[model samples]
Target: MKPFSVAYTSACHFGVIAAVHLPDDPAPVPDGVLGQLPEVERDHARTLGGYRQVSFVGGRLALHRAIRGLGRRAGPVLPGEGGQPQLPEGVAASISHKRTLAVALAARDTHGSVGVDLEDLGPARMGIADRVLVASERALVDQLPAQRQWTAVLLRFSLKEAIYKALYPYVNRYVGFEEAEVTPLRDCQADVALHLKEGEGPFLVEARYQWMDGHVMSTVRIRSGTPAPE
Candidate 1:
């Protein structure tokens, strides 16, 4: 109930979910991160790298609050597969990020778990889909009104990444854009559907995408162990 910042949250078979926004600050040239950043990323950082450390702080704090809040009722935090943070023993958890938010979810009776994400919308990049967007996705994104296509592209890209992070620890399977298709629901307030293709993938993934405050934020949550509700 804390004014816990969030990009997304949901009740699960486990406990509760918390998502924090990773504030964008001018990033300092940290020894390791700078070296690891791609050439292009490095170039961008060069312009205003002085305050880029808040990327996940908001999400981290929000997660802690969620854990604390859940602990008040469920217990403490536990670590999950790949050293991911989870609820105390006998609990399951998942974390996700998009642009400036990180979300964490937990429950006592879920296997697949929960995840959330946030994405910032900006000017259209030249041919992003050529590399990240799948063929069909590219076609769909391109089909949007010229003015709206970029938002749609960013929306899909952000949601897909969140879905990947949400299910990665449990499924441990590589998910490309083709594996997950996103369809936005229509309404003043709508949610995005993270449709896992027919195969060995997350059976049901739920997500929400919103264009607010001049940025596109998206959240993805997947429930595990429980069979997909028809």
Candidate 2:
């Protein structure tokens, strides 16, 4: 059997998302999997242990699958500045993993920088509502049904994380949770407004999220040369 099974693969507005479900056993990342990675990545994986290694391997596998779906041969996705995946030229991608699942979102560079994040929908995250939501966002959540408030908060939080990942390669700076506001729209879409300082003014970014196996998968694509409305 394959070391991991494909949980899902779907086309998105930005590109494609591939999710891989890893085996429960974290050690010994299955035969031949390491060979699939570039020498650099294999060497790097050697430095990791336990679940970290599993996550790294699973992420790379998912990424390769995603790039292939985009009609490109996958290359070494080395870690660039800040450990972001340095995808092959003309490709934009992001990776996120939680426990046994790794998810990747990839697109042609023409789609601009892209990011994906996977967050577990668990009660433990319920208490983070105040920490992640801005005042206006909190007000929005307050209007939700009591049972849905935490889900709303988590959705916004996940989208903001994706927004950060999508924008960081350009801004190359820390973007706090409060720096971006996410207004969730219907049909699994959301709008992002960046509150960067004067010079960091504009970025044309779009955000979306979907529920998968009790986790929220969020993605954002920032189109180059397009500016966000004032």
Candidate 3:
């Protein structure tokens, strides 16, 4: 069997599973796989173009595979609080797509919650970094060499997204980029502290990233308390 790009790390109690799919030569996804998506997903699919459709399906497929690998049966993957993929009870997961590439991560509820994101490496978007980075984050970016700063900025962006996804069920509200501070550590790993506007937080999530096939893929796993009531 051909291999999928997957990374695994122990987070919380159980394991965090991150899987990546590069559809440069994707195999066909079964129609039955599409059938497993909830109505919201079906409607969302209708709005996707050809490339997105393929990546969406591929993401769903990768998600299913991840779930099954966790020893659970594959079932409907729905959108829940904050539009994140709602996993089966006792499961927490996240999915992200960039152009033709999609990535997903999952862990049993016992493992806490997980969020994954993928971003293609490229020249800096003119105003994006400033808009997304908080004062300290921007200052840190300035400390890096000119050429490598954008990649760091993009990595922070991806980690912020991963944090939002990981905590939305707990926070149950929109989290902006400025709410969290991301510090990239060594070994392609990073840490985030969520400074939510209200509620009991300053939640912490850890992230791991990889650079592959010209893309930066990041995954955040939170395994402290259980997910917030939904």
Which is the leading candidate under lDDT?
2
lDDT for each residue of candidate 2 in 1-230, tens digit (9 for 90 to 100): 25566777889888988988877676877557788787788888888888888989889889988998999977678777777887788988999998778999999988689999999888656778777888999998999898998789889989988988888788887788888889999989898888876457457888888997789989999865656458
Lowest-lDDT window of 10 residues in candidate 1?
49-58
Candidate 1: tens digits of C-alpha lDDT, residues 1-230? 22224555555333576665454443454544433333543454445533333433333445555655565443333334554554455444555555445566555434455555455566677477665566667787778888888777777777776677666655665666766666666642234344455455435566766566666655555664345468
Clashes of each: 26, 0, 0
User: Which regions of candidate 3 deviate over 4 angstroms?
Assistant: 1-49, 224-230
* Winner on lDDT (1 vs 3): 3
Q: Give every collision pair in model 3.
A: none
lDDT of each: 0.55, 0.84, 0.70
Candidate order (TM-score): 2, 3, 1
lDDT of 2: 0.84
TM-score of each: 0.61, 0.92, 0.79
Which residue segments of model 1 deviate by more than 4 Å? 1-53, 71-111, 187-202, 224-230
Ordered list by lDDT, greatest first: 2, 3, 1
Q: Give the residue spans of candidate 2 off by over 4 A.
A: 225-230
Q: What is the overall TM-score of model 2 with all chains considered together?
A: 0.92
- Model 3 residue-pair collision total: 0
Least lDDT summed over 10 consecutive residues: which range in candidate 2? 194-203
